[model samples]
Target: MIETPASIVADRKSVYGLRTYISLFSSAGIGCYGFKLEGFQCIASVELLEKRLKIQRYNNKCTLDSGYICGDMTQEETHNAILREYDLWHNAFGIKELDVLIATPPCQGMSVANHKKGNELKRNSLVVESITMVKRLKPRFFIFENVRAFLRSICTDVDGVDKSIESAIDSNLSGDYNILYKVVNFKDYGCPSSRTRTLVIGVRKDQLEVTPYDIFPDKQPEKTLRETIGHL
Candidate 1:
């Protein structure tokens, strides 16, 4: 269920109630938003970094209701364990389906900062792992976020030549899901950060609506970094 502005404000207390099952993968930004929405109550979360796991537990007060799995998602055993632990296969939540799945795979390979180096090779396979998890979880909605440079990364085609990132996503999720991609700047969304991110939202074809992009604000007030900084 996509949340509306009025509902976000009026039903803030129960906003998470609408989402009984949520899976967050290698998510740091979501953790920030989770605090605001009390998203620690999500059914399951997975993080590979120990420091990040510590922070998640501390911030969430080690909540027992939600399960946190710490391991590399590239491993099949880890992936299978997450499925069994979350009971996603059995639909134990009684909703008959998982609500949402969010993933922000390591972006170093797709980041401009790694230019000229072979960091791309290091992080290339993680993208496939992320997509694999999405295919297995089969959530109602899935969101993937990454750096703008990701749009430039090339994927090897059958001809052994490079193809655009859009082509890569199209080949991976075309018939199984309908994907909407957008490049957004935080400043344009009234956030102080000049941070720009590429967000890809995937909805099963059966769930297509009149406007898949209508969920976000069309226009937002601009905000400056000064307005967001605190003085010491």
Candidate 2:
């Protein structure tokens, strides 16, 4: 059972069900929230930073068995290595599909450091690749985390070039994917950071009825930084 705070900040139970295999991408091996799921196990994790991977491996040592894959996700060799380690392949891992995939691609393009350079060729290309992976994996559910600028940037296309992120993703995926895009704040979800992120959730359309949003409503009051920091 989840420990009850004075009030529920986010109803995780509504979002994820019991006993799931989760794949975390480009983050510190599946942030604290993933641990909150009652039976959710992070079977596979990917991180680019060596230091962050070390920290994640150490902290989540007991929870994660195979260890986190440290490298870029876009590289074919890196992706193959991760799949092999996780036994994601048919007959080998005995696992056919994953339950959930959570990715926080680099937000540098949308970050304040980039000053609205979200449309950079490299950044946009990475985002496209991330989406393509989603179509290939076809997990029951997926969560994409990016800076707020992601929602604001206008997609572009060169002559005969399909540069739109959504277009690239759609071309790869079947027509049955249902996606929900929203801008969320960590503060409102009981985190101390004032970070605001654009989240895109994709699920097979037939499964949309089971989506967790109904159980977890938006518009929850923000938990002040002071309230969170005091506990630390």
Best by TM-score: 1
Clashing pairs in 1: none
- Per-candidate TM equals 0.75, 0.74
RMSD of each: 6.1, 7.2
Per-residue lDDT tens digits of candidate 2, residues 1-232?
A: 2232221223234464333344545466545344434445555677777787776776663234454677777688766765665563333323456666777766676576676553465654566556655666677777777778675543333223544555554554437566677788877776666878777777766675766364233565677678757778
**Alpha-carbon local distance difference test for all models:** 0.61, 0.58
> Which tens-of-lDDT digit does each residue in 1-232 have in candidate 1?
2223332234345745434344445554343354336443355567787677676666552223235677787687778766775574235333456556777777777776766767464364455565666677777667777888665676553234456666766677667787888888867877776788888877777776723475444657787667656552
| lDDT leader | 1
